[model samples]
Target chain A: MENDKQKFRLLDTLYILMMIVPIVFGIVLKILTTPQSEGIAISGAKIFFTINLPIQNLPITESQIHSWLVMIAITGLCLFLTHGLKEKADTKRQHIAEWIVENAQKLVIDNMGDYFSGFAPFIAAILSLSAFSSLLALFGLYAPTSDVNVTAGWAILVFFLITYYKMKCGPVVYAKSFGEPVPFLAPLNIISEFATPVSMAFRHYGNVLSGSVISVLLAVGLQGLSSMVLGKLPGFLGEFPLFQIGIPAVLSIYFDVFSGVLQAYIFAMLTMLYVAGAFPADEYFRRKAKKSTI
Target chain B: MLELAIGIILGSCALGAGVAMIAGIGPGIGEGNAVAKACEAIGRQPECKGSVTTTMLMGCAVAETTGLYALVIAILLIFVAPGRLVDILMETIK
Candidate 1:
């Protein structure tokens, strides 16, 4: 018991250090480094720093930096949640962690069946990354999801997974399946197959980006309206954006918190559905039976 | 001539954005119908409320895609088209 306690303490220390180091390092880097981007970045994520390599210059943008921070934060949360987990679940953190894991596992099993239960972690990772990345917008940071490239990367990965699973039945069979009902529809099948990733990426990226864009437009409009309404006041108080205070908070709740989390859930759910649909139940069972026979 | 050309282009851009937003009506009606059906389903089987809500949300998100695409086009027209068009026209005239 004493040895176990010592081990727990060491792990706790490590977790704390792991959480602190990246954040501190990021802050130091941000303060010390001169921003390499020149000229006004009109829209989209602004380039923060450009690293000149022998191969090509890598321009790090706001989305990349903020995503890195979100990843670090997620890692820290995981560490904190799993820190000193006991078998009997004495602590609240342990219960929370167990509950989260149990629900995620159950969701995967329910959606994709028992055969694909292994996908729970992947789906959970997607859900957390999408959710937290979009949530970053609440803190006035550039959300990585708002940049179509990030969501496109995730969608493309999902598309590849779907394609790989579909091809497991054999590439010839898969290609033939595309022309089902009519060989003339082969081109349409190909287009639809390609459309999956594009649609998923655009759906997620557009929702988050539109939310932010609308918020900015509303804020600017509100400021102008407020100045027009309150301009009669004397001194500096006249220009104060009085009307901009409470109105935006109402919109923020819908645009940021609700829409961000909902989009994340939809994206993860769609990915699970598409991937599971790629491999039919009969094929899965046949493979399982074959393995069992061996 | 340049000022008049710029004005016409900007005005058309605004008009195009407004027209693009007409796509919003489809999703609005679709989601309303979806919610109404979901309400009926829940009323019939209250215990299935959780599943019904989830399905409704997923359907609504999918339905909203067309509206979102239109919004994106409208945003591009309003914010991007005017500037680019005006700039191109100025260069051509010069």
Candidate 2:
């Protein structure tokens, strides 16, 4: 473990840059470009980039372009940085793939106590992507995690996967897993199943959007105090922070690291739980147990 | 005008960012809790380390996302402060 720690790698640097550089760039940029009058400048459509899908008037602007330039540059640089680096993406991905295939199945059997190894990657990817997106938002770019479509798409896909997993666990028993009493409640069970994806998607996106909005408000509001004191100094000197490293730093600790990961976990955990619930009981004792419980 | 206006943009960006960073609070507590729980689990069931570790890490990664978003916002605020420059421009006009 110590040897592994000692072996400094590009991904580490890449991740650090991913974490630090963007904020630095954004801070420097924001300080340089912030305007006083919000009315006129804030208006008009700002377009960043366009794809096949049309967004009537995009929210992108020249400043946003410059902002994204820094972001894209870092991401692009990461690719180059990792290229031919000791730990190549391809190698790590391949090794991960192999490891997951080899150990994941056995581990699932041992721990999860049932089958379904094929879908583990999907779970991992969605969970990680959500986490990464929230982290990316810290740099001021619109977070993919905050996008309802992105999250909803993921949730719906997960729903189908769970259904598939349920089918695979036991075809005859799959339908029986739901609406156990009588048969009229089948629609209610189906609706409840449908509710899973909606909750799954909204849970993540809402958390991110609320965090983004609230934080923006608080940080914006903090300036209100400074603004009140502006030009109030004896010689019209600017108001200096009480302590350069205290309150804001504390705030940083709270917002930048904690909420980001929690929401991601919540999103993924809910999906997994829903999936786990879909599994049929392994009834080895009775032939009648194979029949539909519904 | 442009340069001074540009400078204040960083303030708003920082504000936005500082706000963004608030989300980190949840994750910090969460990851700590997760680590503690994982340690407890390891002590309780050493044989289940692999599964426990994997699950814990995966959960931790998810918990970390909110912080990431805030970090991004904070970065954008501190580094770019796009609105800061806009303020400078307003100052010049004033």
Candidate 3:
């Protein structure tokens, strides 16, 4: 309990920081990092992707690096802020927590070691790529993930990682994955594998791309409404000592914080699930569930 | 002609954004579920509340991704769009 409190203090603080930094830095990123990307003409000439924000583009230009930095920073700060005490945990509670953590670690190590030595690197790469892409988009940056090229790269890496891990885990059955129970299905399986990356890429790219688009539009709408309805004629009418800024503030809260963090986690987790599922490694949580049920 | 053209682009963008936000239903439901589960877990086992909360938050965050994407697409469609082509096409037709 004591140790848990200490750990929780740091982690909770980190979470709070994570929740807050983006609200501030998101605005900052918008002004600074928005990319100056030119799209290619059909004739193979350069045309730029029009991103209005400069800083948002920084994460994109730097790919995953810039995004990770902000994410890590926010996380670190949140931990710093939420620092708690080291109280003694009872044996039962300590054992349970330790068991959960250790089991998870063991599963990860076994899967990564016995199966794909590169599993850790592969997952990290995918996560970094996504984190950066999302942070860019969140901050109103023109992002590579905004473009299909970067997304495709993400898909390709994921596809390869899945295949390599699968092959190592079940070389025979994996080979059988192609030219499986029936010959015709072989082509279909290939397509499915191919589709894995494409769908995964689109899913991540589409979500970030769409979220960026909507928040900006909503923000614009709210700002326009505020300027038109409230700011105008307020002084002429007799400026009420009580002003209501709450309506737009509520809208801003939902658009900026709640949705942004969720999207980043989803993109990263899907990548994790896809990679982990490929190895056919039984997850610790699921094992725990089964054991508890028994 | 220009006014009509701009209106068309802007209108289409707005329409598209509205469509994108329709996907928000997913995350809204998922987050609620996570919260509910977290509450239940907390009640059942207060000791592991911290870890449970973390896990719940992570799950909720993942759930929010789809909605976020919809927002991004809608934004692009509205503000940062391919310009002039639509206007030119409208002009030629007119």
Candidate 4:
């Protein structure tokens, strides 16, 4: 207990130092550096750095770096939560872990039925990754989901899962399934199948991108307004954007917090629904029985 | 001549973007109707609030797709179309 207390005190001091050092450095740097002429430059994710490949240059973007950071943070969180686990819940981390897992399992079971309880972890992974990626915008980082390619990649994976599950009934049935109701509708059905992933990708990407775009626009407008109104004031207060402080936070609550988490939840729910629906009623039973027999 | 052409192109792009945003009206109305119905359903049977809210949210999100599509088009017009149009015009002029 004595050793643990000493270790925790050391960690506390380290944490405080880590938090304060960069902030102090940033303030000093800001004061020393010349003020930028440009008011606010709003644009898409910048290529942070590039790697020279054999065929082409691989550009690592702001979104990509932020995503890596988010992944690392999540991994660290998981490690922290699962460390020193016992048979019984002796710690708060263990209790929290159990709660998260149990809730995820319950969500899958409720939405996609008991057979899809296996998908709980997958759903949880998507939920966490998507939500965390979006939430990064709150910290003034470019969100991965704001990049169409990232969301497209996830939507494509979900699309493949949906198609794969649908094909489990048999190739013949899968092919014929498109021609249902009438032969004339086959092309439409095929187009709709393709549209599923496209819409999913665009929906998620557009939401996050629009949020960031609007936020930037609002900040720029507010800054301009503030400058117009208070540019004559003495000292740093004149240059500083007073109006840009609290109002943008209100919009950020909706765009960054609510919309981000809501979209993540909706994406997960849609994935579950589409994948579960892909299985024919008879196929679901057959698969269940097969698993039981095995 | 080049300046006039550039102005014309940019003005058209802005106009197109504004026109595309009219698509938002449909989604706004549709979502309002959905919420109203959901509210009635909840009022009738408050016990099923969980499922009702879930279904309403799903429907609203799906309904918002058209508006989002329009938003994407508008964004493309505002940000992308002008540059491409100017480039093509430049090439043609050259």
Q: Scoring each candidate complex against the real one, what DockQ results?
A: 0.66, 0.05, 0.21, 0.80
- When sorted by TM-score, best at the front, the candidate numbers are 4, 1, 2, 3
How much native contact recovery, as a fraction, does model 1 achieve?
0.53
Q: Write one digit per residue (lDDT tens) for candidate 3, span A1-294.
A: 899778876776667667666556645654564446532111111232444676664223443434445556545543443344235544454555455445544544554454444444445444544554455544544554555556767678767878876775357757766886797888888887887776666666665555544555655565555556656564654333222345544643454344444544555556666676776455444655787999
lDDT of 1 at A137: 69
Least accurate stretch of 10 residues (summed lDDT) in model 2 chain A? Answer: A39-48
How large is the interface RMSD of each prediction? 0.9, 7.5, 4.7, 0.7
Worst 10 residues of 1 chain A by lDDT: A33-42
Judging by lDDT, tell me the better candidate of 1 and 2. Answer: 1
Tens-digit per-residue lDDT, A121-239, candidate 4: 89999999999899877766668899888889999999999989888877987998899989889999999999999999999988888888898899989989999999999999799
TM-score of chain B of each: 0.98, 0.71, 0.81, 0.99
* TM-score for candidate 4: 0.88
Highest lDDT model number? 1
The docking quality of candidate 4, as DockQ, is 0.80
Share of real interface contacts recovered by each model? 0.53, 0.00, 0.32, 0.63
Candidate 4 chain A worst ten-residue window by lDDT: A22-31
Q: After superposition, how far is residue A4 of candidate 4 from its true place, in Å?
A: 9.2
Model 2 lDDT per residue over A1-294, tens place = 777655545556666666566556655655566566662121221344554446575454433444354446445444534444444346664455455445535543443444445656555556556666677655655565665566787888988878886786456777776756868888988897887787667667656666665665665556656656563665535655333325554554465556667777667666666676665545532444656453
lDDT of 2 at A64: 47
